[model samples]
Target: MKSLTQGAHHIGLTVADLEKSAAFFTELLGWNEVARNEQYPAVFVSDGTVMLTLWAVKQEPSVAFDRKSNIGLHHVAIRVPEDSALDQIHQKLLAHGVEVEFAPEPLNGGPMRHMMCYEPSGIRLEFIWPGE
Candidate 1:
């Protein structure tokens, strides 16, 4: 079937701490804060190529997303230009006290290298570098 969409325009994520999550993209990753909505309490960030819309959770007792059972987003895998970037980001994540699932290593015995970790708001992120 012919697809209507060209590619991803943006991604919206529901986070427990909107400020911290926004800071993750802006402060840690050095992405720019494009816009914000006080009414919905959402922060929009962009890294020149990709944009993320972080929405704040309204109430408590919120359940965390389980990739094994949940029928939602499993994880967001971001690509880096160079292989060393994975290690660099891993170091930054560790220095900042972010939870690291694993260090940079061969991805499933493949040529690509990747590392996984949880951001401040408990969202799983994977950083991968395509070796060439």
Candidate 2:
């Protein structure tokens, strides 16, 4: 039998506002908006490597994110080129008024550095630098 799955093609997120969420990923993460469909109310952004699809929820009740209680996605962890990048992103997130879950710190003790924050749609995002 052959394996049917390949690496992750994209991640789709349901957001309150498509434009805001699209801007958030583009401005902060340096992703590029590749496509948009007003009819489906979906926007696609790419980091030049992976694509993220943001879908606008219509007439649906909004719910707060609770990692402890929710059974679905916990957070999306993105890899950074260097440890210094984490610090840079920390400042950018702050400037954009995004909530930083915690300052960048060592994950367990060796060389992994990471920081956590929430996107505009209440989705948790993590940036990590494995080591130099």
Error of 2 at 51 (Å): 0.9
Off by over 4 Å in 1: none
The 0-to-1 C-alpha lDDT of every candidate, in the order given, reads 0.92, 0.90
Kindly report which residue pairs in candidate 1 clash with one another: none
Worst 10 residues of 2 by lDDT: 57-66
Evaluated at residue 105, the lDDT of candidate 1 is 96
Q: Candidate 2: where is the Cα deviation over 4 Å?
A: 1-4
Angstrom error at residue 84, model 1: 0.8
Per lDDT, the best of the predicted structures is: 1
What TM-score goes with each of the models?
0.94, 0.92
